[model samples]
Target: MIRIPTLRHVATRSLRCAARGAVQQRRWAQVHDVRFLTTQPSQAILEKYREKLSKKASQEGHGSIDDLKAAYSEKIQEQRKKDSTEGTPVSQPNAPSSFPPSKPAPKKASSSGEKPAIKPLGDILDLEKVAELPEKELTAIWRLRHASSPQTLCAVIPAPAYQAMESLARSNPYFVLPVPHESQGAEMHFMQWTFDPASKTSTVLFTQLAEYKARGEFAQPHTTVTHHLDLIKDKGLVLMQGQVMEGRNVQPDHAKWLVMCLQRFYGGWEQKGDELDGQRKERAEERQKLLEWFTNGDPRFSVEKLLEEAERMG
Candidate 1:
């Protein structure tokens, strides 16, 4: 004989069916509340891979994982540049790329989506017609010139700074040459300068004299560090520069010396300029007060009127 189902069994069977249907319906739409269930690699997984990469980089002669990554990025950049330049794909002998071949990776950008900076243009110098450029255009040309060889510019100090330093240096008949990180004990130094108004060029001689009658092996420029300054008056710019006479037999720390000397001169020049400006301002203010005092504090009368009255009385 067939048996009838109890009331509790019937309710339980309905609940089970409902749960199965819910699971089926919500499979794709379910929120991933668990941390590790996301598609992207977790922090721990990334760190684990980074460590493995570091080891591989060491074996492959890279200084660090960062170095390896930089080299790889450089190679890719070079490849892209080659393709862009030659209009053809070139086979690279370098190691294969880390990314999957099936999908092309997206270009990397800054958070603001700024375009990547291209390699700077170098080995270009055009002085002709550079003078006719307006101030803004001239500044552009200056930037390009500086960018091409920034290291060379460290040795180039402003003309104003050199003039200010020259005035101070002349106070002493003979002084020690200022070399960064070195001392010239008992040895004297001096400068001899000549200017040509026509060419607007100043030739400065930075001479080093050895100790009186106390001699060891003496090296040139015993008196030979020469600097040439060319003034561009029309553009309100000075093309002053100091250069070694020769490439050989120079100071071991020549680069450092140039940098330090430039720093000192620039600082002194700025300070002197500020002082001179302050003095002029103070004098003008005093002259204005004197005029006001004479005019019984009238706003209408100015220093010009006072001078005019004095000239009329004479």
Candidate 2:
């Protein structure tokens, strides 16, 4: 019984071996028998192969990698061909025209031996509006005129005085006092009020005889008083007084009295040779040289001489 069982086991093992050998032989036959192309494939053959791959993929219900790649390449080529053929010019936004025709140059002034016509003094004065400015502004305008020169109060007066004058001219049209000629011998003098005005202002401008002469060239001296008053009224009486005091580096009290003496001599009967009432009148006349020296910008006019002269007069 044991011999029979062993023989049966051997038979079963042999059958299993035979089945394995058959599978191995079939696999080797398949690998060896299948043929591959020996020559380089043509483009047409590759295309046909691609088509077959696509058909096979479609039948199997999925897209192949080669099929998708071929489709993408064809789309790109179509886009490039369309772009090359169309060649559209890009539209640009409108820009402003460069260098538009320039305006023609103005015609030159006629040289027909005709001088520019001068406007009348009345027209130049602008009097209707001139009358409206306050007295302080008028004083300022007069001060502005004399204060313009370097030899006069220009050296003594602060920069603000010049600025104030400029500001006054800009604000009030009447405050415009244009120096007519460069060579016009304009002289300016400052004076204080002895008998104060009803307005209680301490200072006034006293135009010298020289200024009077220039006044005759343009208009009467007294007629220009409106213009003068327009200057003072705008710049303010106290402001002028403060400037005089600051410029001279003197006490306001002394400067005030000195200015009064000036006003007395310039405004009073000194023009007529008639004497003023008090000893102050005589003293002011005696001090005329010093006053002229001060106005003339003479650096040599010593404080010693001024004090000595003051002592003699006193």
Candidate 3:
């Protein structure tokens, strides 16, 4: 009843339990090793892994294993385009032999073969052949008495008197003995005066368009003024005094030059104009005296007596 087992029996039972545990562990180890080599993955498990990879690729954008093949193909096409654009020759191991090489086009010539030549003035004018020039030029040469038309004729004389003036004009200063042209005749003279010294006087002639065109010989002067220049007393004033003949003097340049010369000699002619004014006043006083004599002596025109008589009658 309640008796303990012996030592030998206990050792033998413990060894048996230990050996069964070792056998169970070896069986579990064999199952784990074989599963690694022979067991196939399930479809559901594969689907879960594929979903995880797709999620990872979507999170990282296009830089994924699935898109790598397309990216590589695009890179190859871009390289080919770059090479062609840069004019770099591309070497292919097996290239097509059907296409031919291109060549550059030749340059074209200008449409117009040559430019026109310019003519010299000598060729246009033909100076060697004077007769070949136009009729107008010939007429101008004949009328002007020179190659170009002249404007003024100047002659310095000894004094301002008319006798001295006439002598100088006849001898020189002008182109004398001009040959008359048929249909055109000769040009008329437009004359003026300029003085070199205040004492010395000169008769000047100018060419006007009308006078130059007129078909006649030179006529009498349009105007003749005997200007007295008193260099000593008046300094430089030209006295248009003594006898001033305002003939037909149409040329203003003649008069202007005369005035300018007078101003150069004398400061101004305002005092001369004043002297003329005194002469005019004296003449007016003489006229008043003549009118008074007629009114008083001849009773018919007495205005005061007529008015008094009329008032008395009224």
Candidate 4:
């Protein structure tokens, strides 16, 4: 025979169930609030794996883990030194606390993403006694901050002017020398360059492949050419003489294209051949466009104007 349960017993059982549900809900909310949960490999999990890997490495007699830790330590020390020198606040990377006590990241100085302030040409020219500055600094000061096209295509600029162009070009993502363009498809390859301010000369080393191969990304330059230029002050022309130091791997077709570019852009020579072919005509048209862009177009290299505006604003 079944007996009826007491009302007190039923009420007590319901209360206990509610309490367990509340506890579970609170635990789930805490997990949801953790920021690392949304990103790949939660920080806690990463640390756990890292510790396991370190232990394994130690046992295997490979110091990979120790080396990585040492490198990170050195980086932290360098950062601290820099901060101290610059009078900025420093934070230790290996602090006991893994994460910062909930704080928002600092806002950037400019929200609009505007370009940096420009100084006037006059102010730069009239600077007090001048001493030799590093090549990088000189490049920065003399940089062509505004140019119409990626390819400057200027005819014989002075050493200083060309260097300024190179400064800007180096910063560009697509800065490949011997850049072929015409009726045929483009063949793009990387280029590395070095400059000597005293001698007013530059050397360009062109790579063979557009992208990395099995051998490596950078093999010795397929073609190495040193450019010696004479500055014609009155005409504002740069007369370039190229000496091909190395071209063992350069194909015949590629060499022809390279010479054409060197003559048209650097040497300030018009494209000429026994036969006036389509390629020659195309190059001539390109040259004309560049000339028009430089002469009629703004060309936008007035440092004085920019600096004056900056000072006026101040």
Best-matching candidate per TM-score = 1
lDDT of 1 by residue, 124-154 (tens): 1223444445655544434333333312221
Candidate 3 per-residue C-alpha lDDT over 273-308 given as tens digits, one digit per residue, 9 for 90 to 100:
244477545543333332333323433432222222
Q: Which stretches of candidate 4 lie over 4 Å from their true place?
A: 1-174, 177-187, 210-218, 229-239, 243-247, 259-314
Can you write out model 2's per-residue Cα lDDT over 112-209, one digit (the tens) per residue? 44221211212223445445545544335434534432222311222333334333223221100111111221112222111113222222232222
Each candidate: RMSD: 33.8, 51.5, 62.1, 29.7
After superposition on all CA atoms, how large is the RMSD of candidate 1?
A: 33.8
What TM-score does structure 2 among the candidates reach?
A: 0.19
User: What tens digits encode model 4's per-residue C-alpha lDDT throughout 1-314?
Assistant: 11212322332333354456554322111111111111222244336568786877787776876564454554443332222122112223442232222222232223435221111122222222112333343233322221232221112245554543354334421123222222222233444454544444454545543222212221344444334342323333332322222334445445434544433433233322334579655554544344233233334412222222212212
Decreasing TM-score order of the candidates: 1, 4, 2, 3
- Model 3: CA > 4 A from native: 1-200, 203-208, 212-217, 232-236, 241-314
Per-residue error for 96 in candidate 2, Å, reads 65
TM-score of candidate 4 relative to the true fold: 0.28
- The alpha-carbon deviation from the true structure for residue 275 of candidate 1, after best TM-score superposition, in angstroms, is 4.9
